[model samples]
Target: MDERVATALGEAFPERAVDRTFGVGPSWNGANETVGVAFADGERAFCKVAVAGDGSRIARELAVLRYLDAERSIAGPGVLAGDPDADLPYLVTAPAPGRELLGVWEDAGDDENAGEVEREALLRRVGATLATLHAKRFETHGEIVGTDRGGGLALDPAPWPDVLRATIERTREIGTSERLADHYDAAFDCVEATRGRLEGAPAALLHGDVAKPNLFVSDGDGSDPAVGPDGIVPIDWELAHVGDPARDLVRAEDQLLNGFDSEGPARYADALYKGYRDRAGGLPPGFAERRPIYEVVRMLGRSGFIDQWVTYLDEPLESLVDRADAELRARLDAV
Candidate 1:
């Protein structure tokens, strides 16, 4: 129970009394804090108080929630109060329906083969949701409020390839190491040298971080007990941006089906792609050509942030980066 939670809630919901609160979220490890709260008046809202480094994320998420709820019929959290510029930036949102998809996944974790049908069904819905989001179009790829999306100078949209290159470059800087930066540089160069492939990447909505923790499932507004196509609701839009949909799809697969190692059978990914195709009428143009490129780029970005993903490394940063380099080369060759 961090004291910041109460402070942010008090500021946001001065009218209601905050009560019975506990920490919630994947990053509750101290860097960023989120709490599920129940007020004295029987109302509930999710609270997120961003640490200094996470102010922009909180701001972006608040804006994204407003955009989706107001403009799109997406059934995700709605912003109740926000102070993006506050000393400890924070936002409060009405609890969207359904349970966290991670919990559902965990119930089937002990046995990978458990609930195979159920698991694939959920993945299909996740895919359909992605298809639904892809419908929200933008002229150029970049931030939602970018000049391309008709906003002030806060963000300015650019070509898809340009944004992809910029993201890889930024990730490299943020995750640089003398021992590994060189290998990382090679991966970046390959992507740039073959950047012509990205021309087919479309400027579409991307649910920046499409991990299990960010998805929700419910029958409906507490009306029934069934999880189906419309039951799928994705939360956490802080990373949401206008970018290549293929890049987004690959990242989603990384979290949903496989990671860098890619050991497990990609059944979930297959179902997700099928659902996406069924909804979109067909896969995007040049999908086969761009998928691996985006996967390689995603791997490079993940390689940069070793500390964040070290849990999966099971080895020193040196070995992991060595492995990342090899993986990058292999994926590039496959492309």
Candidate 2:
């Protein structure tokens, strides 16, 4: 354990004695470190610390969680304690509602038909949860600085394109942007070229990172073991922002369904979209028109992190680079 985590645990649980600390799961974000804490009296909680000494992410999450609690837009883990201003900033939260979506999806087994059906049902629920979050509309898109007294987001207003560009710039702070630096330039150019189309997109609360690990399956009723009435509860709100719902949906589909090269079964995409359409009347207003550019922008996830991909997929670095380069060109061409 890093010395910072120990200090944060002491700060978060000043009165209680910590019995043990355990790993939460795999997390690729180098900016933060998380651990599951077990207290002497048998209570368990999760703690996330900003190891990089930048408290902005912790502050953003604190603001978003408070906003969610106040607005009741959707279910999220209740924040037990947090202070982004602390010397070693940390957040401790009560356990999320149910099993992680990744664990639940994996447990379904690979029996093809049965697995796909179960996965589809879970994806539908995720779709509904996203819709609920995105229902909160803003006239202009901006960076969420904190919460207002009335429980609304206090945003630092900016154009949607600028806001999106800021998010892309985050890859640079982490080491990913350094790996394929040119992709960053290309993504910026693409965002600039499509600035007009991205200008008038509907602004809503977006879970910027919508992967399975960040989502949990609520313990619904006995009928469907995977999904509950509350739908899927999302955690890790540090990435939450006010952006285009169409951009959010595009990201959700890519994160949830697509794999390397942005390839995945068409059926999975269909089920996911159907769930969103079922709730939102149809896809977000500009989904179809703006999707190609979003796809182009999404390539940064691959291009910027090719090194991690080599380890994750256990392939040679050279081979992964070649594939990523080809895939990136294809996406850029599409845009």
Candidate 3:
């Protein structure tokens, strides 16, 4: 147990004996320090606290959770209690229902009866859940308002080009294998060439990070049952901001396809777009033509940054470079 977290929980819930258990369960984003914890009073809840610098992120997440809880628009974790004054800011919320879709997919792969059906059901639910969130209207957030679908609060897109350029340069400054170097250079070129095309695209209220880990799914199993009238529940609003809807779609598609063959990519892309169109209005004008470019640019920018941190993790840079290269190739083919 983190001493700060322990003290914070103890102070916040003085009446209950809070026992922090160390294990893996689920999280909204990466802000939560303690993984799985069981409170002494038999309280079923999860805790997320900001570390050193940005307590505001945790605060913002708590605010969003509170708003959602009040509206009851979607099924999300309920706030049990929290302490902002602790060494680290923290919030305790009753655990939301359902297993992460990734876990479900992995488990179902081995299951005999519910493999394919479960996977498809989870995917559709994910699509529907995103639509629900995107469909809502908001009066105010940090800096933006209105549920324009593309015009919610978000990190400034103005500096993205420069940020990406700097990230690429920094990756080259650090050591990279020859194969990675070639891929990096090629990806950079693709981004630079397509920069103008993406800069002009419309933005929306995006989940910020919409990958599999952030997505929660339930096939009506376990204590956290699957969403009933609603579908999947999109949690983790830390990165939620007004940004390009295409960006969200791309991220989701990448996770769904998982760098598989071109066939899988196409299938996932088609299914995702169809679902998006069915729920939201039609795809943004010229979305199909612009998607490949946007995806390559975003992937290059992301993978390039991640490559700089490869020293800390065991992830192979070659795989990231390969994916970027494939996305780049697709972009070129599309053009």
Better of 1 and 3 by lDDT: 1
Q: How many residue pairs clash in each candidate?
A: 1, 1, 9
Worst 10 residues of 2 by lDDT: 221-230
> Candidate 3, which ten residues in sequence have the lowest lDDT sum?
139-148
Question: Residue 253 CA error for candidate 2 (Å)?
Answer: 1.4
- Better-scoring candidate (TM-score), 1 or 2: 2
Q: Give me the runs in candidate 1 sitting further than 4 Å from their true place.
A: 1-3, 28-31, 108-114, 146-155, 169-184, 220-229, 308-318
Please write out the lDDT profile of model 1 over residues 127-173, one tens digit for every residue.
88788778766677776542224332145567777777666664564
Supply the global lDDT for candidate 2. Answer: 0.83
**What's the best-to-worst order under lDDT?**
2, 1, 3
What is candidate 2's lDDT per residue for 1-335, written digit by digit as tens? Answer: 56787899888778898888899887768898989988899989989999977788888888998877777757778889999999888889888878899899999857988999998888887887778778778988998887777877888889999999988887656645366778888989999999999998999999899999999887655343123345687899888889998888888889888887755788888888788778777888888888988887888888878887777889988887788778778878887
Q: TM-scores of all models?
A: 0.84, 0.95, 0.69
lDDT of 3 by residue, 1-335 (tens): 87756666776677777666666543322435645568777766766666663465565556566555554545666667765555677777666667676676688755655576556556655665555555653332222221223422333334334434543453444333344456566657766877776555554445655666666664453233225344456666654554445656766766576543243535445656666677777765556666776555444434444544355455677776666577667766665
Candidate 3 residue 270 Cα shift, in angstroms, is 3.5
Order of all candidates by TM-score, from best down to worst?
2, 1, 3
Model 1 worst lDDT run, 10 consecutive residues:
145-154
Residue 166 of candidate 3: its Cα lDDT?
47
Candidate 2: segments with Cα more than 4 A from true spot = 221-228
